[model samples]
Target: MSLYQLVYYSRNAIAGDASVFEAEVDAILAASRRNNEAAGITGALLFNAGVFAQVLEGPLAAVEATFERIQQDERHGDVSLLALEPIAQRSFSNWAMGFVGHSAENAQRFAAIGLTRGFDPARLGGHKMHAILRDLTLEEEAAAA
Candidate 1:
C-alpha cells in the first residue's frame, strides 16, 4: 500500500466557555487518537492561539477518509488543507495522535527554531507551513528525549 500524508490547519469553533473548549479539545484529541490507531494512522496536532495545525500519515484511503471527516467536523472551523502527497516514509510514525497546546514559551521556541513571527499557517504558505511543523516536531522530540 502506498503511504500518504495530509497536512492542514483550522480554527477552533469551540467558544462561549473556557471549560467547554477544554472539554471539547480533550474529547477531540482522544477520539482522534482512537480513530487513528484503529486505522493505522499516525500524526501530530498543534494548537496555538486558537489555531490548529496537524499532519496525518497512513494508507491513502484512510488518510483521505479522515480528511473528509475533518472537513465535516463542526469543532474545526475554516479548515484548510495544506498538503497531500505520497511519501516514502512517515515523519510522525511514532504518534497515533500527539497533541500540543499553545503557549508563549512554545511560540518563542518555534520562532527561535526558524518559523516566522506569529507562526500563522495561512500567512506562511503551504511549503513553509510543512517545514515549520516538521521542524517543531523534531525540536519537541529532542527536548523530550
Candidate 2:
C-alpha cells in the first residue's frame, strides 16, 4: 500500500463546560485509537487554544476514509485540509492516535517556539503544525517511558 499523510486543523465545536469538554476529547481519542489501529492508520492530535491539529499517515484510502469521518463529526467545525500527499514513511508510526492537550508547560513551549501570540494552525501551515505535534507527542512518549 502507498503511504500517505494528511494534515488538517479544525475549530473546536464541542460545546460544554470544562469537564464536558475534557470528557468529549477523551472519547474522541479513544474512538480514534480503536478505529485507526484497525485501519492500520497512525497519527497525532494536538488540541490547544481552541484549535485541533492532526496528522494522519497510512494507506491513502484508509487516511481519506478516516478524514471523512472526522469531517462529519460535530465536535469539529470548519475543518480545513492543509496537506494531503503521498509520503515515503509514517511520522507517527508508533501511535494509533497520539494526543496532546493544552497545559501551562505546553503554552510556554509554544511561546518559546515563536508562537507567543497563540496557536494558529492556519497561519502556521501544515508542515510547522505537523512538526509541532510530532515533537510534542514524542515528548509525551518520553515522559510516559
Candidate 3:
C-alpha cells in the first residue's frame, strides 16, 4: 500500500461552554479512534479553543476518504489543507488517533514555536505542524506511561 500523509487545520466551530466543549472533543476523539482504526489510519490531533491541527497518515485512498468526511463535519469550519503527499512511512503509526489538548505545558511549548498570541495553525507550514504534533503527542504518551 502506498502511504500518504495529510496535514490540515480548522477553526473551532463547536459552540458551547467549557464543559460542553470538553465533552464535544471527547466525543470527537472517540469517534475518530474507532473510524481511524478501522480504516488503518494513524495520526495526532492538536486542539485549543481557537484552532485544530491534525496529521493523518495511511493508505492514499483511506486518507482521502477520511479527510472528505472531516470536511463535511459540522464541528469544523474554515478547514484548510496544509499538505497532502505520499510518504515513506507513518509518523504516528502507534496511534489510531492520539489527542493533545492545550494544557499549560503544551501552550508553553507552542509559544516556543514562535506564536505569541495563541496557537495559530494558519501561520505554520505542514511539515512544521506535523513535527510539533509528533513531539507533543510523544510527550503526552510518555507522561501517561
Question: CA lDDT of 145 in candidate 1?
Answer: 92
TM-score rank order: 2, 3, 1
TM-score of predicted structure 3: 0.93
Give the winner by TM-score.
2
Question: Which residue ranges in model 2 land beyond 4 Å of their true spot?
Answer: 115-118
lDDT of 1 by residue, 32-77 (tens): 9999999999988877767888889999999999989988999879
Model 2, position 97: C-alpha lDDT score: 95
Report every candidate's CA lDDT.
0.81, 0.89, 0.89
Candidate 2, residue 2: CA error in Å?
Answer: 1.0
User: Residue 82 of candidate 2: its Cα lDDT?
Assistant: 90
What does candidate 3's lDDT look like per residue over 1-145, in tens digits? Answer: 8999999999888888889889999999999999999999999998865888899999999999999999998987999999999999889988999998877777777777764456567678899999989998898888889
Among all windows of 10 consecutive residues in model 1, the one with the lowest summed lDDT is 110-119
TM-scores for the candidates: 0.85, 0.94, 0.93
CA RMSD of each candidate after superposition: 2.3, 1.3, 1.4
**Backbone clashes, each candidate:** 0, 0, 0
Between the candidate structures 1 and 2, which one is better when assessed by TM-score? 2
Off by over 4 Å in 3: 115-119
